[model samples]
Target: MANAQLFKSMQQSQPLPAALARNAEGTPAYALTPRHQLAQYAATGCLNATFYASAEAQLATVLELCKAVEPSFIAQTAVYCRERGYMKDMPALLVAVLAGQGAAEFAPAFQRVINNGKMLRNFVQIMRSGAVGRKSLGSRPKKLVQAWLNSASEQALLAAAVGNSPSLADVVKMVHPKPKDAWRAAFFAWLIGREYIAADLPPVLAAFETYKLDPAQTIPDVPFQMLTALPLGAQDWAQIARQGGWQMVRMNLNTFARHGVYAIEGMPELIAARLRDPASIAQARVFPYQLMSAYMAAGENVPTVIRDALEQALETSLLNVPRIAGKVVVCPDVSGSMSSPVSGFRGSATSNVRCIDVAALVAAAMLRKNPDAMVLPFEHSVVTCRLDAHDSVMENAARLAAIGGGGTSCSAPLLRMNSKQELADLVIYVSDNESWIDAKRSGATATLGQWNVFKQRNPQARLVCIDISPHATTQAMEREDILNIGGFSDDVFKIIAAFAAGQLDPEHWVGEIAAIDIAAGC
Candidate 1:
């Protein structure tokens, strides 16, 4: 019983390698190790996968002894016991599929580990030359292996992976070794045929080539509105609604009196009599986030480069005026992998709220451009506060709520940002880019350039990526250097941080696709 199926595949772990815990601890690890016969073949014990007479001769005897094993039981099994073939290891499955587990649930044990393929093509060129996720990357592949290398099936490869439109060569053979599947005919001749960040992605996701002999009981659950639908044009759909945004200045007041009353008074024929019967549009978009937070007023020329990115984020706030320094961590993301539901309000009781929190309550008014700033709350990670750093991160995120939700973690609050870097050492992460930072970092180096960890342990730090979904107008026409912060109005987020600081070249304007009604609203 080959050591009781190697101890029933190391106590039912399924994904096992590092030479079955360094050759069952006799100190024989993975990757071409001197490993003395992998500690007498993982201490024999009588191999287990429940006495494999079948699971296809126990995964073809773990991929024919992981293709003539040696580099110590081929990296010593783990990705669910080397994708069920008992752990054909390659330096412990290349440090567990470059730590992001590339395509887990035993990604077809990436087919006997690509039999000598540049460790799955240099782990997709070190996560597509982005150099692994940046708030200092080290957070394991928590973001579903960076959403399987930014998906792509078609919609013109999710509109050229978000530079908006262009992906064909028959949708680049469904996301092959990718660079939008090798510039699909120079991005479908640069989309002269509209391409909104298309996405269908499923071509052997993270390469596996197939052969371990039947074990894939089926998987591939990818639906976040099909990779956040990316197509736009006609002057970038009127600058995503001339940046005044939110469905291009969405104002519906059949009765806006607010904090005083009238709250959608009868609510658009009570939402056309509850959408002609039942009851829920989240109770009819809860009177449009309460009349868009009571007709949100305040905007006078917020330009001087967004008053210098709110005075360089209020001179890295050690706090001043209205009592200085510390506390503003509003981390609310009710997980269970965020089960989407929210549509339009007050009903049978439900709210998966993520319409991009109307751009996180309009970027938490950038903590009134900084003063005591705090909003503490989180999911999948950070959620514990005894309430002190002098209170008020919006009065302790109004005792922030969380019934529970899962899957979302970015290095679980590295000891609360290294024990509060003197009043928030600049962290302005706002998601909906569908989080991703597939791990790896040690003596860092790799740049699109944005460095600043000064006392944070630099990896070219300066960081800031605020993509409020609708794929930030296809990642601002496809990354000339990534800044994408389009409008939800505080005068369209101070002209989207001065059109993301090229000082604003909104190309004299004319774009809005509020779900197309006949066409172009002047």
Candidate 2:
């Protein structure tokens, strides 16, 4: 007979490399490269209080990571997060760090990342907070701010003036942008409370000033906040609702209903039509989870038609979720920490969307696209969640999110799969990546151990870990067969599809960031 040792399973699992550090959960985990850490935080960090990290701790970690990586990498990561990941706070923070470093890429990165007034304000606030390094908007950043102010259209500027405590008006005061024309000069003067000819103001501003003085005028097509203080009737509020953009409409459904917009003839149908418009949804870059947030936040007064429209828009937004060609397993982490808001706690400003909501949405969308996919909701163990292929994605997501709230064991599902000899072409995990329940002190993470066993049976299987929180460690090391990505944007689905088709290198998420053309004109 052949020697038993020689004939034994050649695929016996080997010990993994020693963990480089501990995760937020105080468990042994691999440390990400500086660039990878920066990318992870940039994509998912909101600079708020996460379950595992405080706002102060997150800020310090981000600054340290920025120092370790090349300034250019920071710039690229900022652009990648803002443009592709559709993140807001973290990208602005990265750009602020670049400004502090005085890198050559700062100007272009600022121009690209600070695309809107809110973002510009964020960058200015971060600079002035002295968190990154400087406490003042130095000459370069001030110049860019001035340029941004000069370049914005009159309507855009008016909309930008809605927020306060360093609002657009405050930014104008800081930058003292030189006016290019008489209208701008008059507008700047009016913005800062200096006297100016009202007629010289841009059309929208002129209309706004007139409307403010007399509530009888047709509500100006300015931001809704600008009109909220005016004494207006239901019809006036209806007109404002009619003029609101897609995002504005989605966010203020309850407000619109409260203001009697739905009571107006034909208003509900028109708004419903707008809500379901595919082109507008794509242009707005609306995430499915965002629509889910809107849907859940809508009050009883919100129109049924509008509620149906939100569901339709959610489906339209997820049109890019790929239908994989083979067996797929989606394991969503339903641990207790996932109950915290997706954007982290920021007092009253925290998002209503929870991390688990996004994970469940992703898993549900995948199941909808691939009707044969298996969904396993896990915390310390595989929690059974029954989902139907034909059920609405939102309903299925709610079901999956309702199950587990125990300690995280990222290895639980994989171990279950190994025991059952499950075959899968792709194993997807949507989690915070703070696994600790099954962590090892001197060997590979239990996740890696189980994955190795699963790989022995299916050599070509690929694992995709979609982290939805801001953290700097992972359960499994990145390799040719593994991908670690962050963020809740639907763009993630496209990236997953490309990776599953072998269109990306092992560098995966970081390679995508590294490939950004930072030198390209903004």
Candidate 3:
């Protein structure tokens, strides 16, 4: 004898949409458009083997995506990824594709995307590898490379020399850039192994040469790789640690400790102060997850004072994490695949931070900002993880990441909320978006169905799916209420805030990429 209106409200009112494709785990999922796929790859892809895709597979997919989209879209995506996503390899690869296609948008996009020496090397290497059609840097690309070499400052050029296999010297040999000044002329000659006046060499390069010739001389203020090959004492390592930038110090804390940088008198306190400096952290654009990595990787020999500073740095970096209004629920996917490195596996170059670590960090960060928020860690089902609202983000994240390694069920958390009749204004999911265990055979995905059921109780609720891997599928379709974003960068927080506030258009993430001003010089 229930009221007809009430009974109807309890049932799903809208027809569920069918899943467009299968995920890496053979789960029914909604596929992203070609542009969306490219953006997703550009943001999170590291061109390495992932849990579901091999390096060759990812590369082939990216190349195919470049051809599927418009040349202008490629340019915009490159700019957006480089400027806002803070990505490296993917952006360079995109530019290489544009160059090979002979697209007119290539020049300006190249100017924006190739902003550093490492990027220049990547572009050069990708072009010459014939991966993007043309095997060599053609006239336009060669001119652009020459211009970059000619306009670079002495310090930038020296820093560029730090990496190799197609080192700055190799690049000089390939492009043969004409020097604009005596210092550049000497530097170019020195790099390419030609006769040049040592006195005319830039001050930093001259100092580097002097130190290279005599280990007793003072360590030159060059890239750390430029000095690591030489035998250095404790005092020498300490000096390098003191002079290194915030990012360098953050990444090499263990190296510093191994070489006795931390054992020196008062060096620990000095390094600790630098680590916690707000201005330095901002200037370095330090990602919050990077701090987590540093904290977890610090060796026993590392000073406790420095370790504590890393925690502080993480807190500072998370200042942008939005404080959502009303009831909030954070669902972190702790599936077995998430145990893989967040940046994908690259042999020795693989990142130590797992995808689960980042998922937990995002959940913990949200809880830290919204104290009353509920955290649900899920794999095949909801995992029991009791977190303290008063606990540190690091502690809570550690607790959440330590649980759940079963198959992924993206609907588990939503279904749990539905069973509890929980009303939430916001639900944030940090996952890889491969929901095989709960995937539906027909109609909408199990995730979408569960979301609809949950929405029946709380129609005002908004869902943000933050994909931490480079995949082109999701558990739920993007609508006015659902948002899909990629990458583990802090920028994801800002995008989430804007979407939750109803500031984005229907196109959402793709619109954001399209809005990038690639027409400035085109």
**Candidate number achieving the greatest TM-score relative to the actual structure:** 2
lDDT of 2 at 392: 91
Clashing pairs in 3: none
Best by lDDT: 3
lDDT of 3 by residue, 1-522 (tens): 879887776565758789979998887899999999998998899898888898889999999999899999999999988877778889999999999999998999999989889899989989998899988899999999999999999888988887886899999999989887999999999888899999999998899899899878878888888788788899999989888989989999989888988778999999999999999999888878889999998999998999999999899999999998789899999999899898889898788899999999999999999999999999999999999978989999999989858999999999999999999999999999999898777888999999998888898899999999999899988899999999887888988888888998899988988888886643
lDDT of all predictions? 0.30, 0.89, 0.90
RMSD of model 2 against the true structure:
2.2
Sorted by TM-score (best first), the order is: 2, 3, 1
Candidate 3: lDDT of 396? Answer: 97
Assess candidate 1 and give its lDDT: 0.30
Instruction: Give the per-residue lDDT digits (tens) of candidate 2, residues 199-248.
Output: 78988889888888887778889998977776777898788878999999
- Between candidates 2 and 3, name the one with more favorable lDDT: 3
TM-scores of the models, in the given order?
A: 0.19, 0.97, 0.96
Give the poorly placed runs of model 1, Cα more than 4 Å off: 1-156, 163-239, 242-522
lDDT (10s digit) by residue, model 1, range 47-99: 22211122233333333443354322233332212222222222233333334
The local lDDT score (0 to 100) that residue 463 gets in candidate 1 is: 26
